[model samples]
Target chain A: MNMLEVTNLSISFGGLKAVNEFNLTIKKGQLYGLIGPNGAGKTTVFNLLTGVYKADTGTIVLDGQDLVKLSTIEINKAGIARTFQNIRLFKELTVIDNVKVGLHNGTPYSTFDGIFRLPKYFKAEKEITEKAMELLKVMGLEAEANFTAANLPYGKQRKLEIARALATSPKLLLLDEPAAGMNPNETAELMNTIRFVRDNFDMTILLIEHDMKLVSGICEEVTVLNFGTELTHGITADVLNDERVIKAYLGD
Target chain B: MKKLSKSTKNSLINYGMVIALYVVIMIIQLCGGLSNSMKGFLVPVCIYVIMAVSLNLVVGILGELSLGHAGFMCIGAYSGAIFSKLTEDTITVAPIRFTIAIIIGAVFAALFGALIGIPVLRLKGDYLAIVTLAFGEIIKNLVNVINFGVDSNGLHFSLKSAMDMGLAEDGKIIIKGAQGISGTPQDSNFTVGIILVLITLFVVQNLVNSRDGRAIMAIRDNRIAAESVGINITKYKLMVFTISAALAGAAGVLYSHNFSTLTSAGDKFNYNASIMILVYVVLGGIGNIRGSVIAAVILYILPEKLRFLSDYRMLVYAVVLIVVMLFNWSPKAKEFKEMVSYKIKGMFAKKEETQA
Candidate 1:
């Protein structure tokens, strides 16, 4: 069964159609890529799926539930988490603390428990910190866990964002431009880390990226969008070689 | 008990020190050359500390500049005052009556704050500031037009009859149009004030350091990202706003009984008072609890100390806020890094010391 299934999803800004009749499906444990040139409505689709923007039409189903009806937080509770195109870490919070925010849903402590330093609160906090640290370690960010997110190098910030998303225990992860500003070496490392997280965490990832090498190397499945319409989809090799995908990139 | 971090342990010690210091000051005030009238200033300072600290929760952590805080305080004060007056005959015990009044006041204020937060919190940044400011004004106007008084028949009467009834019978109780309410019970003692302050400080301190507080801060830092990661921004924002309002309401109860005579909440809880509390939070460092509390006390006391300045005191107050906010800008990059390094060093040192 598909982990995420979208059908006839559409949104419009006045006369401008941002995304229309967008549909796709991916099975569990799939690593998929969504790519297009600038202003291709790629991020717009991400926004709609995450409830940042309400879809003007259609349904999103995940794990046999109607996801379109859920609020963003509720959708996340149902095992969907995302990172932003522009790295949006909680800049002032410690790196580990940022990751811990992802674990807030799982934390059982109430306000009283935390304030009074109740035993349960401490136990939950300890468990959360340990789990956050483990995610950071897998992402090669264990050493920088105590540092503020804003102070990290750009590539590390991207990885930290992914680590934070992973901390949510998501079944399907959405990443927007996971390698926007990375150097070639940093991008290669990110490719490996993304693959490692996919296998280790047993996750299905849907990512948006402009880098063809990273997208082609890591994603087994790929979907292409152009002018808010799906141009092509299927295995990465077949979709990447589509004439429309190339023309959309070459602006022909 | 779970193992405590050094900072957590130090915070506990610091809280104990503050309570002790306040106790010493109270004793000195009672025993020293200061007269009873001079000691009255402590009541107002404690009141401001509660207001500043509670307001900090909304303004600092939630990252919403709320200008309607005094409205919530007004609601609390007036409701507390009215409740105490209504139940005075029923309950002879002073402290119990006072506690009931404060709780009612806080509940009412929290209800109103939550109601306002629902519609107003959707607006971002400056729009929210303006919306809250208007809400405060609307509350003040509503309080002015509101008619609340009971006659000897124990029947609720309008302002006009209440005044006429006052003059006809024993001229014991009187409240003229826009005039202050008089004949309130004087049961607010320093002990009660200190206890409530402790509760407020404790609750806010815990909230800021908890997962809920961290999520609120994350929402403040990056709304889109926070939402993407599954945080309900609206829920957390409204929760903090209501909690802050409830605390402000508690402060209102303490303020009401501390003063035997008071005017309609219109005069007492105004825009400037809320701004003053905001000034305290900003001057103290927004998210720093100790800083905001100390700032509140210092600012509240400064006016009294410089009473000789009289006409120039307001000017001085404005200048102080401006100077502090301007100079204590965001922490420098190097300093922040050093602070992090220090935390790490301290952590290792504690580990080694514990082992030894």
Candidate 2:
């Protein structure tokens, strides 16, 4: 069964259609890429799917759950987690605490349990700490778990954002410009990390990227967007070689 | 027995310091080292500590500037005072009555916290601050126009004049406009104040270490990221705000019960009072709970202790404030403080290892 399906997704800001009639379908465990030039509304698609933006017209079904009317937090709980175009870590928090924030929903303790430090609070807190540490270890950030996030290097900060997202245990992960500020080496490393995440977690991913190399490297399928509309979509190689895709990137 | 974790050990040390300060004060009191005036300030010091610590939950942990904390304090003080007055004859036990009054005050303040938080929490930064300031002013003004009395006929209320209350001839006026509540039972003592401070610390510290607390700090650090992580922003925001306000209300109960006469005046429960609490939180370090406690105690007593300085007392107090601010914010001072704390922690760890 398809993990996610969007039909006729549309949004407009002051008569300019930021995203219009956008449709997408991804089977379980598929690694897909949404590539577009500036102003193509790639991020807008992610925002709409994640409930950050209210769609003018559309239906977003994730694993048979309608995500349109839900809030951002509800959509996230419904199994869609995303990273940002800009790295957004809880800068003052320790790296592990940043991951713990993602694990918040999974814990079953209440505010009273927390205030009183009930047995469940301890049990759940210990489990969360273990899980958060495991995520940090997965991202090779175990050594830096106690460090404040803003103190980390740029590349590591990006990696931490992904780790934080993965900690949410989403059925589908959305990456918006995950490699925006990375050098070639960091991008290459992120490509491997992304592949590792998919293989180990058996999770589906939808990535938005302006970097052609990074997108074509790991994506099994690619969707090209132009002026908030889908231009073409196919296997990675075919879409990259399409004449329209080239013109859209280079500007006709 | 299992060895204590580093974080747990650190927190134990923090609590130890608070208890140690209490012990020292007790010893000083026994030895008659404190003047009667200083003894009078003791309960108020504990009250202020509770206020500062509770406010930190909002200003520091939740990362929302609340200038209307005094408003919650006012709600708590008046509600608690009135509850005690109405129950004065019924609840013969002093401690029981005081407990019920504190709970009533906290609940009432928490309700107001939820009411104000729902609308203002949607706005961020300076806007939140200004709206909360307005809330404080509104509450203060509302109290001034409020006139109420309680008697065998139950409760009577009026917004205009006390004469308009239309109560029985023997109806006792509980609140008389700007004059506020008078003849409130002074049932609170240093011990009760200390217990309340410890309770506030326990609740706040435990929350800070729990999953909910982490979520609160996450929202403060980055609201968008917190939302994307499946955190209910409204739920957590309201939870923290209500809890913080409730604790402030508890402090208000302690304050009101310590005095026979209580008024919602500019000097007592007004905008400046709110700012004073915020100053304690900031000077203590925004998210530092222990710092808030220490800052409140020291700052509250500093001016009184410097009374011997007389004419130059406030001048010295102003100088001391500047130095503390610099120490907190300056890079070199921060490094020095970190080094000192690191060394202290290292010493404790070594001692534990040797004992093991």
Candidate 3:
């Protein structure tokens, strides 16, 4: 069953349509990719999906709940989480603290408990720290837990963002260009890490990427978009070989 | 935040020595024949320290510029002052009224913070600043129009009649006008003020270390990324802003009671006070709690302490503030750290060469 269903999603900036009639169905625990050239409205789709920008006309159903009416935090509470295209780690905060932010959405303690450092606060904080550390360890970022985020290397920063998103405990995770600036070796490692995160966390993954190689290597299914329109969709192998996707990507 | 380097630890220990020296100054104030009136100024200075530090949480930690701080403070002060005044006549209701007033003030400030935050926080950068500044003005003007006094007939005193009663002078009584409210009961003491300072410190510290606190900071660093990560940036930001405002409101209650006067909510709530607090945070180091506290104390006290300089006192103050900001004298300042480390290295190098 599809965990997220988007039909005829479109958004516009004044007279210009940024994303038009985009549709995708993501099932639970399925690893999927959305690939297209620049201005294919890839990031715009992510924004529209996350409720950062309301779809001008579309229906977004996540876990059987209509997402169009929810606020950003409400969307998160509804079990959808994502990461940015550019690295957006809290630079002044420690790595563990960054992950703890993700865990905060679901923290069960009250503000009163936190302020008074009551038993619940202590229990909650300890649990959060342990959970954050576990996620960081899974991402191979445990050693840098105490360090400020800006001090981490580029690959580690990307991992930190994923670890943070995972801390939110979402059923479906959206990654926006996770491997954008990485070298080949780093990209391969990221691909492995993404798969590992998927299996270990048991999460449905949807990512937007320009790297056709990474897209084809890890994604079980693929969707292609061009000029804000859906160009094609199917299994990664078959969809990637389609002529429309080729022309949209290569422009022969 | 790391284990302070050995030398830095030693330097911190030296800071303890500086505190000891300051203790001697306090001793001199007590023993060197300074009048009690001269000591009265210390109360406001302490209150300002609390106010500025709490305000810094919003301005620095959450990284939002808030001009509505004084408005929150005004809310606390009025709520507290009214509680104390109304209940003081009945011994049975007085303490409870007073207690409830403070708690009520905090709640009011939080509600106001959320109310104001919804619309104002949607604005980003300088637009946020401008909206907050306007909110402060609106609050101040609202207070100006409000008349909270009851006449001899036991009816509420309107602004026009209250102004005509003139200044009610009984020893240290100090306010009188639609311009300001005076004759407020002076019931705050050092114990209450200090206890409040400690409370504010505790609440702020806990909030900053909590999950919600980090979420707020995450939103602050990058809204899109924070949202992408399911942080619910707006909720967290509003939460922190409300908490910060409530704390400032509590500080205001303490200030109102300490002075036995209210600065006509309209008269004193302005952008200047907000900017002064902002300067304290920046001069100290944004997001540095101890830095903001220390900066607040210095900024508030140094001005009065230098009062003997007469007119030059303010000149000296301006000069000192300029020097601190320009020279980077605060502890967390990069330049200040460099200068101290450079001197420390110089000292250590001499010792090493001499031992060699």
Candidate 4:
């Protein structure tokens, strides 16, 4: 069953077609990959799906709810959460606090209750802290829960982003270049972590990547985007082996 | 009871510090060590401390520079003073009357905060600062021309002069244009100011540690990432901005009530006053609530106390200001302080081992 379905997604900036005629479908438990050369609009597609940019024409259906008209915050409320290409953790906040911020919408308490420390404040905050700790433990960051987000090592910061996104309890998780600045060992560990999240959390993740090894190693199915359009989509092996994809990444 | 979180411990320390300060001041007063001038500085110091901490919310946590903070204070001052002037006879009880005045002022200020924040919060960086600066001036000037009167008939308002309001003989002018409001019961004292200070501290410090505070600080740290994680940017920003404004208004109520005559005619609520409050936040170290409290107290009392060295008073004051700013903010100073603290802790550990 499809968890997220995007049809005819297109957006433009100053007459430049950043993303054009984009279409994607991800099954409920499948780990999907979005790959393209530099400037081929992979991030733009993420922005479109996440409502960072309003689509000029398209429908984004996630779990049977249309999200084209929703704002970025509302889109996340509809069970879609995203991480940035460049790590966007709340740098000043502690590791666990970053996750608690993600748990914000999930746990509801009025600002009044918080300021005055009403009975509800203690209950809600206790619930939120416990939940955030669990997510941190899942990401193997429970030990560093009190460390500042920026103080964590590079690979661990990326993991923190994943942990934070998970705190929101989204149905579809979007990862943008999760292994961009990591060593080979970290990349290997990240591949295992991604698979583990999929199995444990029952998450359907869509990611954009330039590392073909990471893409081919973990992705069940791949969609290749070239020049703001879908060049090919199929099983990972077949799509990565396509001659046109190689040419698009390399030369004419 | 369960173990406390690190943040909760820090908050407890801050509250303890405020209580300690209160006890020390009260002790000094009881011993009759406080001078006439020192006692005079007491309530104003509390007022400025409240102002500094409230402004810190915008400049530090909210990550927005607001130059028009004094405008909200002006609103609170006038509204509170006017209320007190109108209800002096009906509500003869001072504490109850003052509490109601504060609530009225805070609410009145919060409403204006929402009004100005809608347009002002939309701007960024220097534009936000410029607009807020303009707003501060506008509010001060606006209050200067307002003539408000209350009579047996009803409340009366005029932009021109008190005579234009056509109030009856029994009616009293609450605010007489440039004269402002006079003869309002002086319900604020050093003790009441300290209580308000504690209340402000409780509200601000607790808000900073709460879940909503995390969302607010998240927006400050990274606006885009916050939104991506499902945090509503505008809602949190406006909410914080309004709260900060309301707190400033509360401070204004304390300020106006302490004085027999309350007026915005001079530089009390001017651009300079706004900038002075900002200086307290900055010198105290932005985002440090405890530091704001200390900075407000010291900076306010330093100049007044330095009257003995009249010739070089401001010069010495300037040096102290720079020293405090550097000590609180400079990286080298921070490292040195941390190293010294570590050394002290290590000494205690060695002594404990020796005792064992």
Give the best candidate by lDDT.
4
Residue B52 lDDT in candidate 3? 71
TM-score of each: 0.90, 0.95, 0.85, 0.98
Query: How many clashes does the backbone of model 3 have?
Result: 2
Q: For model 1, how does the per-residue alpha-carbon lDDT over A1-252 read when each residue is reduced to its tens digit?
A: 799999999999999899989999989999999998899899999888887789989999988889887888888888889988888999988898899998888888987798787999879988998999999999999999889899999999999999889888989999999988999999999998888888888989999999999998999999899899999899998888988889989967
The TM-score-based order of candidates, best leading, equals 4, 2, 1, 3
User: After best superposition, candidate 2 residue A125: deviation in angstroms?
Assistant: 1.3
Better of 2 and 4 by TM-score: 4
* Model 3 chain A worst lDDT window (10 residues): A105-114
Q: lDDT tens string, model 4, A1-252?
A: 999999999998999998888899999989999998999999999998888889999899998999999999999989998888989989999999999999999887898899899999999988998999999988899999999999999989999999999998999999999999999999999999999999999999999998889999999999999889999999999998889988998887
Worst window of 10 by summed lDDT in candidate 4 chain A: A106-115
lDDT of 4 by residue, B167-200 (tens): 9999888889989889978888988888888888
Model 4: DockQ against the native? 0.89
- For residue B42, model 2's alpha carbon misses the true position, in angstroms, by 0.2
The residue ranges of model 1 lying beyond 4 angstroms of the native Cα positions read A115-117, B1-3, B6-10, B30-38, B151-154, B159-177, B265-267, B330-356
Query: Per-residue lDDT of B216-310 in model 2, one digit per residue for the tens?
Result: 99998899999999988888889988999999899899989999988887577888899888888999999898889989999989988999999
Error of 3 at B112 (Å): 3.9
How high is the lDDT of residue A190 in model 2?
92
lDDT per residue for candidate 2 within A146-179, as digits (tens), equals 9999999998998899899998899999999989
Model 3 over residues B1-356: C-alpha lDDT tens digits? 65643323543443453355346647867687657755675556557766776877777777887776777878777777766665565545544565566687788878898988887778777888888888877776666655555433443544454554333333111123344556556766655665566677677777766666677787777777777666666777788778888887777777777765676543456777777777888887777766776788788778778878898988998888888886665556777679889999999999999999
Count of clashing pairs, candidate 4: 0
In model 3, which runs have C-alpha deviations exceeding 4 angstroms?
Answer: B1-38, B92-101, B104-111, B141-146, B151-154, B163-176, B260-268, B327-356
Candidate 1 displacement at residue A160 in angstroms: 1.6
Docking class of 2: high
- Candidate 2 is scored at a TM of 0.95
The local lDDT score (0 to 100) that residue B175 gets in candidate 1 is 37
For candidate 4, the share of real interface contacts preserved is 0.88
True contacts kept of each: 0.68, 0.89, 0.73, 0.88
